[model samples]
Target: MERESDVDALIAEGAAAPVDGWAFDWLAGRAAEERPPWGYARRVATRMAAARAALDVDTGGGEVLAELPQSPPLLVATEGWPPNVTVAARTLRPVGGRVVAVTPGAPLPFRDAAFDLVVSRHPVRTDWAETARVLRPGGTFLSQQIGPGTVRELSEAILGPLPPPADRHPERAVADAEAAGLRVVDLREATLRTVFHDVAAVVWFLRKVVWTVPGFTVERHRPALVRLHDRIRAEGPFVAHARRFLVEAIRPAD
Candidate 1:
């Protein structure tokens, strides 16, 4: 009875918390994930320092972009989610960055060769052709992408046993980039540890990272949540692995 009450309270806390912007500060002590060794944010800052013009694709709430110590002369970020567009604009205002609302999987709304540097962190999908089109000759496109089967353990904990990951492989991305006429200069991969102290953390994460469960809801997955909560109580904290990859491609000089 006491365990049930605890579960109920935790679920309510997680469900009621706002899942706005891409920041994960809400999960402070509830969950933790190891950072990738490639240091994507630091790399972006270094590149941004040298860029004349830059574009950030799928800039969720512009949180990552807001961290850069320096900004390009012309800095632009694109977001697909409407809620995030407003958040991103306000967050990037101090940096003189403009936020453009774009449709997911649609062509980037930019003139050819519009940006000298293009970056994206965990974009839902990469339109390689569109990315290439917007990049100037000798420009670079850098991204830290979510690899196939990222956080599969957490996903399966909520959902059921799943099949092998079918896509999001670094090789596939490299092939797509080459096909789009971008030269692949660097590629790196990492599988980092992720831990959740309670079921509430899982609920909030699934809600924010929607791709984890196609259609996640506290009510719909309550049974699984309960089971997971019990399992965590019996075992230690739940553990999962998050896969990430960094790719750097460039357009050849004209």
Candidate 2:
């Protein structure tokens, strides 16, 4: 059995790590999560190649957008998190992409029909109406979204049993897109296996992905963390499932 001191040290390390940007490089060897079958990044790259103007909503750190081989003439990205704006701007500099900071829930600050393509990856919330309003006629909107009950097992491990997930249903997204005057073209869902090799990984993940445990704190949840650490030492690595969905919609021609 690992010493209690070792566990405490691991927890402290995780708690001290910075949670800036959307990248998960910190969890490299300690955790693993399976990716969806559909390659969301590759899909975005393909679409972006054909777009005259493209907008990336909630483009955290512009990590994914920076990887696109080709950038549209007018490439723009929006981020609600202030710290990520500068990070995104620097990352996307080589691609000639601009990052704009905006309020989380406010309407997008852009002219109507300004973009021929819009994309988002794991947005906190989808503003379907605002997305449609900013797209040019016959433009496409593509997104990889977090599905309902995503990473619930990890959450339950930390916070105990919880209520059923009530939102982020694929059907609901289709309906919302249609209501916003966009035609849904495709939808897909995936449940991925996620494994955490150590308690530190769990703590870091919860800190970075705040939605996992609402208001998780090492001090407040020390007992639970201890229990989980013990469980990991006794049993094998803790296992969880992450759910994701991809949706595509297109604004009709004027």
Candidate 3:
């Protein structure tokens, strides 16, 4: 049995590798589909309308920003990954949104209270405080992110017993928002169940889409892969799960 600490170290290390091609393309397509006039696009638009100036954090592929109206002159986007920032700039150019790459979990480049609205999708929790710091009084902070139990089954199968829940909890995020002097008005979790052709597809998706923890050795996961394949072959089309939390909060008027 591997010690919990050992497992964590491995996952942290492996998370930086490029995600699988199939999974990356699938996510890119999903981002395009989930844009405006459809589902969350309406909500995002509504939020953007309320702000004089807007800042989008981690604007991956700029799909969310692209859906909004091209009216906000001060629209700016930041992505932590260089490649993602480059892609976002191209994707958001038509909407006149400027994209810049910045390090996650650090002070934002903008001045304090500089933005009227701050939006993020799947941003690192470490940046929550900085997000609040950058928003003006009464500014809205809207974020959508993966919650705990995201890919729980795959994680458990590959890593043995599940680890203790970390800060990814939606409740904890609400608390973090409140602690950062932001009022949490809406915090909701949406679970989406997706189907894949086979266990191999599922494994590839996890490698690319989910980005398993750093410590996960491809070699160590081979047995788990075999087991998953066997199970899927016996069970038919496999069910994969994903969860996203939609949170809308306001920086205190004071």
Model 3: lowest-lDDT 10 consecutive positions: 29-38
lDDT of 1 by residue, 69-92 (tens): 999999999999999999999999
**Ranking of all candidate structures by their lDDT, best first:** 1, 2, 3
Q: Give the poorly placed runs of model 2, Cα more than 4 Å off.
A: none
TM-score of each: 0.99, 0.98, 0.80
The top-ranked prediction according to TM-score is 1
User: How many backbone clashes can be found in candidate 1?
Assistant: 0
- Per-residue lDDT of 234 in model 1: 98
| CA RMSD of all predictions | 0.7, 1.1, 7.2
Error of 3 at 62 (Å): 1.2
By TM-score, the candidates rank as 1, 2, 3
lDDT of 1 at 41: 96
Model 1 is weakest, by summed lDDT over 10 consecutive residues, at 12-21
Q: Once model 3 is optimally superposed onto the true structure by TM-score, how far is the C-alpha of residue 187 displaced, in angstroms?
A: 1.5
Give the higher-TM-score candidate: 2 or 3.
Answer: 2
> Which candidate gets the maximum lDDT versus the true structure?
1
Residues 138-208 of candidate 2 have per-residue lDDT tens digits of 99999999999999998898789999999999999999999999999999999999999999999999998
